[model samples]
Each structure stands twice: as structure tokens, then as C-alpha cells.
Target chain A: MTSDGSGFRAIPRTAAQTRVLDAALTLISEHGVSGTSLQMIADAMGVTKAAVYRQFKTKDEIVIALTERELGTLEEALEAAEAEPSAARARELLLTRVIDEAVTRRRAVATLQFDPVIVRLLAGHPPFQQFIGRLYAVLIGDPSPQARLPAAMLSGAIAVGVMHPLVADIDDDTLRSQLLSYTRRLVDLPE
Target chain B: MTSDGSGFRAIPRTAAQTRVLDAALTLISEHGVSGTSLQMIADAMGVTKAAVYRQFKTKDEIVIALTERELGTLEEALEAAEAEPSAARARELLLTRVIDEAVTRRRAVATLQFDPVIVRLLAGHPPFQQFIGRLYAVLIGDPSPQARLPAAMLSGAIAVGVMHPLVADIDDDTLRSQLLSYTRRLVDLPE
Candidate 1:
């Protein structure tokens, strides 16, 4: 992972900062990044805009922080996959975690992943680019250029699978099991 | 397909109307629906806002028209698949057309699918909803609730696969082939 020229350092956030990020994420999910304002975040948290501003001075900072916090959830999972002795074991570990997170934060995760503002932010952010590279490395194992499509498709399937309207009525456990089973088929993992 | 309560009627557009849709799609792909306005569409089309307004009275109508034009592309494919003799053939036919469309208009397709405003429009519009349901029916073949997850995941994989940054550098032919191969595997279709 380190050899990819993208560092995997943890983004540390203070408790107060986390609170602001939490409120911002909730509002952003509903109104999107462009529509969300600091005042809205403050109102959601029942705090003055000044208090929210004390934690993050700008909306861009809050958006970046929220993105980092989301990516940070996968950090431990990435490390666990990296440490595994076998490639297959590593993929299994990482995918299990990815599915779990997707199911747990279904709406918020999809909103963030697909939001136009967030998409632009993630693309330009080196840390995010690095984190995504590491995550894909574990999932697809540095495939040839031609093989990148399947790798991309595999990740896409998982990300969009959880929040897809067809699966909206499905409970977490059933969605998790079916996703794993079908994903394994896509990736040619053993039963 | 009509028996499914969703009629597959073609949306007729004049050359001038298509010009507006083309300009609107281009801007909407870049700025999204909410951020885009009639003035931007007029600028893109080298026409006055009144000229654009003459074609469509409001921005919502333009958005809906753009969406209808896009979905209309799939109507033929869906009809062909519906006319197929076997379930397997229908799935294969539908998937092939889907991959082709996804690769051909990679950016526009993804931008429309994931855009929040477009998502809301699609959900609220009966024709779009009917078209999607018919599309899914062909893809999944009236699956039990447990089976909807794979169906959703399969569709998501295709939708997101072409637009994924990982495969961004890959050409259309390679992407189409790889997506088909992996999607076949996921759906248990014989390659």
C-alpha cells in the first residue's frame, strides 16, 4: 500500500470536530453539499453558527472532514487486509468490511459517493485518491489495465448494491449475505 | 410490456427540441440539474432563454424531457428483449444493450443516474418508474424478494462500471467485453 506513493495516514478529528462533521453529514445527505449551509448545520446541531464555525471555518473544510471520516472507517479494514498472509484472505477480509459499512450507512454512503460536489472533492484530494488506490489494490490486486474494468465493476456493484431501490426493503442480514454470495461469483472467490 | 402498466411509448422530439436536450444534457452533466438554468442552456445552444423557453415552458419540463429522451433509447432494447423467446436470451440481450449504452455515453449516463435531482424526478415520474420497472423485470425476471439484491447489484455494477475512475483510461471495446464477461459470471449466464 505504501509503495503506491499515496500515504495511508489516519485523519485525526477532535470530538468537537466530529460533532460538526456528524451534523453536517446529516444535513448534506438531505440537501446535498451545494444546498447545505453552515447555518443549516448549526440548526441541525442546535448550536449557533458561530459555534459551528469555531470547529470548521468553511463549508469546504466541513465537506472534506466528513469525507475523511467516512474513508477513515475503512482504514482499519485496509490495514487488516494488508496484514493478511494470503491475497484471497486479504480480499475476503476487506470485502466483508466494505459490505458491512455499505449496509450500515446505506443512504448516507450512497449520497456521499454519488454527490457531484463530493465526487469532485474526492477526485482532487490526494489523500482520498491514495485511500481509494489502496482500497482497490486490496480488492483487485493490481490487475492489468484490461482487468481494471472488472475491478471497477466489482467495487461499483458493492457500493450501489446496498442502497439500490430493489434492495431497499431487504434487511441488513439478507442483503449482506446475498451481496457477498453474488460478489464472490463476480470476483470468482471460493464458496 | 404494456401489460405491466407501463407503456413503452416513444417520445417524439423535433430537431430544435433535440438541440435543446443536447445542450441541456451537456450542461446538466457538468453542473447538475439544480445548478443548471435556462440561461446556461440558452448559452450552450447559442439561443435566447426565450427560444429555449418556447421549446419547454419550465426547467422541470426540460429536465423531464432530457430524462425521457435518455430512457427512450432503452425502450427499443427493452422491447427487443421482451420479444425474445427465452428468459436467458432476454437477459443476455438486455445486458448487451445496457453495456453498449453505458460505454457509449459513459459520463452522461452516470451523471444522470446518480444525480440527486434526477433521482427525485425519476422516482416521482410514472413513466420513468414504469420504464425502470420494465427494465428490471427483463433483467431479473420477477425474482423473489431475496433475489432482488443480486438484480440491483447487477444493474449497479453495470451503471457504475463504465464511469469508475479505475477504468476511465480503458477503451470502450475492452470495457464492454470485460463488463459482459463479469456480469455473465454474476448472473450465472454461460459465457
Candidate 2:
């Protein structure tokens, strides 16, 4: 639960908040942010809408929390990459962790990334903007005019690669290995 | 419009149907499939819902038609690629055209590809399935387990690259060139 002067908030959730997020994430995956409602999250948890409201006053809050929680998973990896002495090593460490997380939560990750509501939210939200800035800084270094497209493509490729229907049958291990390899090639990392 | 034996129907849309599809694409880009309604489409088009319904009976049909229309843009490219004698040349031709189309209608293209409702429709609809199969076959040759991930990543990267906020400010020409360069790198295409 802290801000690192980059608008990065590390607010830890309470047990009830955790339950709401877990339920909300599942529903959002199936129904999307626009299709999902607060009531749906409540029903999924076998609770009243009021209970869900107590945890998150609005669907927007729930959406923000769910997104923050997903992004939070990458904080440690970002920090670890920041600690690395070599820029290349930092990029490698962060990319490896990113691929692992994307594969592990393939469905939820893609759902969150591609959902129009969530995409708009992330772009306009200061905290998310800051966190993502840090992420790309670590993954591809400072975004120069030349660097931006590759950075964008790298993130998009990995996210879409894991959840793509063509790769739906790909076991996590094979998918992860191929993703890392192709990702490295994209970013010019050593094989 | 005609269907090749691959279940890829090429039914030509009428003028009124074209207008509905255009309006629906704009709305879908902003609100996504689930959030958009016939009322919204009708309102956007300055018509009654009944009038809109005259063109497309269901939201699902609208979704399918929108998708098919988008895919139709690539039909010429796919045909040219198939006509090429060499597999590598075919892939190059298709990849170049795919990038061109993705860049030309960047917003609508990403919206169609990533929207959960549209994604589901594309997956469940047989014609879309066949068209996409033909698409990937040209762009990546085959769906051998090894080719699937790269194929998926290539499409994802280009789609996400064009629509990504990071590159939003980059003019389309610059964006297109960068995308083409990076995509070539990912697929190991000769520059």
C-alpha cells in the first residue's frame, strides 16, 4: 500500500475486497466489463448487491481494482528488473516474468487487455499510465520515437499470442517457450 | 461476392446494408459489441431501429456482417498470395497487405478483433472460421503446432501496434512503416 512517486499505488485489499475482485474478474472474463454488472459479481459470490457495494461503491471501482490487482502481479518483477545492473538483463528478467504471467492467466489477461472499457480506463487513469510507463521502461527501455512501435507490438504480441484461438490448444509450457523465443527475437534479446 | 469451396461466403452487401455496417463499426469501436445496441446504431445513423433492422435482423447478424466486411477487404490480397508460386512469396504478399489494411482502418480493425462479443462471434461463426483459416494459411503457411503461435503473435502485434496508445500520436505513415519493419522482424521476412 504505497505510492512510489510515479503515481503507482500498491494498495493492499482486504479479504472482502479480494473476494469481490476474484468474483468480478471471473465475470468480466466471460461477460466483459460492459456486459458485467455489479449485481452479477454479487450473485457469483452468492452475496447481496449491497455487500458488493460495500466493497466497491461502483462498477468502475471494481473494474479499477481488478485491473490494479492484475497489474500488481507485475510490480515485483518490474522492481526486480530495476534492481538488475545490466539493462539487457533487466529487460530479460522482466520479459520472462511477463511471459510467465500471461501464460498462467491466459484467459483473464487477454480479457482485461482487450476489453474496450478496460482499455479506455487504463489509458485515462494516471496510476495505470505510471505503472505501464515503468513496465515498458524496463521491458524496452526509454520510449524513443523508434522504440514505441516495437514496445507496443511486443506487449500486444505476447498478450494476443497466449490467448489466440489458434494457440488455445497449446499447452502452457510449449506456448511459454515459443512466446519467450519469439518475444526475444522481437526485442533483439539473445536466444 | 461468392464463396470458394472453403465456406467463405462473399455475399455482396446492399447500399443500405453498407450504411448500417459503417455506422455499426463506428459505434462498436467506441462502446464495444455488448454495450452497443440497435437503438444506438439507429440513433447514430439518424434512422429508426426498424429501419436498421431492415438491413440486419439481429445484433449477431450485424456483428457477423461487420466482421465479414472487414475480412472482405483482404480478399484480393489473399487471392494474389495464393496465386504466387512460392510459399515464402505468398506469405510476404499477404503479410504486407494485412499490415496495409490494419493500418488503413486501425481503430475499427482492432475493435472488431478484440471485442469479446465479436471474438465469440468470429469463433462460433463457420464462415468467419473458414475465411480466417484461408487468411492464416496465406500469411503463415500452415497451422502446424509450431506455426500457430507465430501466426497468432504476428496478427496480434500488428493490430495492437496500430491501436496502442503509445503509438497513437505517431502519424499513420510513420506508424505503418514502423509496424511493417517490426512485423517483418517478427516473422523473419526479408526487408
Candidate 3:
């Protein structure tokens, strides 16, 4: 996890860290961070706790790694959004990728937002703070406190819209396209 | 516990049931339905678990009661929206009430979406299902599954946004105002 231009600290990963992260994310998504334990993760992966610990020193570390891995997938998009010539373009580009990634990952995104432990982790970490700022920057495109609600709504919509029990009947292709179209309207995107 | 709407089936509540529900919602919000046992609810209310059982037969009953209490709050607004002559007016009224109810009961609204048992409860219940459908009818104004994403996002933004670590510095007034502003954007409300 390398920092995007925004100086957000993302943990760059090795292949081993990647494997640990994949397993951790799966468990965390379903069971939530508090409900999920390291032992459960090891059992899920058929590994010993010691082996898992070698990859991440603590549950906090595992969470960080998992967050970093998820963010890492968005690194290219983040970079692109930052490099955009205008804020509108940045928001547009980010929204596109957000919808695409959301459709691809679906349930995982919804799960991440609701995990109390992960919520705490994101709150307490400076790098996570910076990364999230960068994320909102692209998501809402303004620093105005006034933008907070729209940003919140946009963020909420992305997380909940794709994975909602309401959307279960929606196919990925339709879900993706409809999400983008509606989101553009929400964000004031030009047709 | 009764179906207030959404696809969820709500348990019918009498006046006696309402007392048990109020106590349960407060406890469950803080502890989560799974983490919140009947002993905890009874302890919180200065009663024994058997006393709790007398009101409701099991933990499932309490969860249904708590959910119904929350959903019931929405029924008035849903009815008002349904009464509206126009889609735009219906969405407007529903949006305002949603923002108000969420802000007034910030903690409950925020926490309910994340609880494992509540999450499951809301999904399986039929009255909840119908209530949710009616609520969404006023909210998105169209049944586009694609349109559903923004609605979901808007819901999430209000529930999680004001409570967000990023926006912690924001006062309640600022949070509420900003959230309302941004949600309008997400739903493409007129400027």
C-alpha cells in the first residue's frame, strides 16, 4: 500500500501478506471484526494461528492489512482521480470505478462499512484517515462541511445499493450501469 | 411487533409489547441483538429473564419487537407520502421525515442497520417487506433496481455519515444540515 498523491499511508503488500489479507477479509466481511477471531481465520484457511500471526502481528494489524488490500485495489483509481484536471472529472472517474469495484466485490463492500471494529480501526488510524480523506475528496469533490452529507449519501449509496437485499434481484451488469447512471444524477453529472 | 413495512415480517405489538420493545431497542442498539441477550435486557430494565419471557417468549420475540418499534415510526411518513398527489412531493416529504427521524434517534438509526440479528430480522419478515416497499415507493418514486442504489446510499450516508470518524468534528446541526443537503444531491433533488 503506497500513498496516492494525497499522502495517505497505504501498506504496500507482499504476496504472503496478500494471502493473509484475502482470508482475513472474507472472514471479517461475514462475521464482522468483533465477531470474527484470529482462531476462526486460521481454521478457515487451514493454517495455524502462529502462521497467521507471522503475517499480521495482531487483529488490528490484520484489519489494517485487509483495509490496505481493499484500498490497494482502488489505488489506481485514486491516483487517476487525483491526477484529473478538474474536480468534476475526478468525481466522475472515481464514481465509475467505485461502481465497477462495488459490483465486482458486492457483499464485501457492504460488510466492511458495517463492521464496528473495522469502523474503529479506520477512525483511529492516521493513514486510514488520510486515505479516507482522499477517498471522500474523489467521492464528494469538495471540502465544504456542507458536502459532508452528500458525501455521506454517496458513500452510503455505493456501499448499500449494491449489496442491499433490495438489489439482490439486480444482475451485476444492470446493477453496475444503473448505479452509475443514478449516481451521476445524484452527483450532478452531465448526461 | 408488527410489520411497519419493508419486506420484513414484524411481530404484532400491544401496549404491553411496546414497553418491552422500548427497553429492548435501547439495549440492542448498544449491544447488538446477538450480543444482547435476554438477561442483559432484563438486567437493563430491572427485571428477570423470565419476566422478559412472560412479555415475549424468546429472544426472537424481543428482536421482532425492537424492529417493529423502529419500523412503526416510519409508517406515518409512509402514509403521508402515499397520500401525496405527486411523486416529487411524496419523495420530498419522505426525505424530510427520514432525515428528521434519523437525526432525532441518531444512535438507534445508526446502529440498527449493522446488527446481525436485526439485519436478519428485517430481511425475513413479510410486513417489513411490504412496509419497506411502500417506503421506497415514496423515496425513490420509481422501482428501478438501478435507482435503488442511490436510495441505499442515501440511507447509509445518514446512518453512518454523521457518526463517521471523518465527520466527528461536525456538530449535529452541521451534520444534519449537510446530510440533508447532500442527500438531495444523491437523489437529484432540485437545487
Candidate with the greatest lDDT versus the true structure = 2
Compared to the true structure, candidate 1 yields what TM-score? Answer: 0.90
Which stretches in model 1 have alpha-carbon errors above 4 Å? A1-16, A43-48, B1-10
Q: Who is ahead in DockQ, 1 or 2?
A: 2
| Cα error, candidate 3, residue A65 (Å) | 1.6
Residue-level lDDT of model 2, residues A18-72, one tens digit each, is 9998888887877678888988889999999999999888888877777777677
The best-first sequence of candidates by TM-score reads 2, 1, 3
TM-score of chain B of 1: 0.90
Model 2 residue B85 CA deviation in Å: 0.9
lDDT of each: 0.79, 0.83, 0.72
Could you report the DockQ of all the candidates, in the order they appear? Answer: 0.62, 0.79, 0.43
Instruction: Tell me the TM-score of each prediction against the true structure.
Output: 0.90, 0.93, 0.80
| Candidate 2 segments exceeding 4 Å error | A1-10, B1-11
- Candidate 2 lDDT, tens digit per residue, B165-184? 88888988888787888888
| Residue-by-residue lDDT tens digits, candidate 3, B79-180 | 878998988888888888877777766666766777655677667777767777788778877776556666676666677775555566777776766667
- Candidate 2, residue A168: CA error in Å? 1.5
TM-score, candidate number 3: 0.80
The TM-scores of chain A alone, one per candidate, are 0.88, 0.91, 0.87
**Candidate 3: where are CA atoms >4 Å away?**
A1-20, A47-51, A186-188, B1-34, B38-58, B144-146, B166-181, B185-189
lDDT of model number 1 = 0.79
Q: Which lDDT value does model 3 have at A174?
A: 83
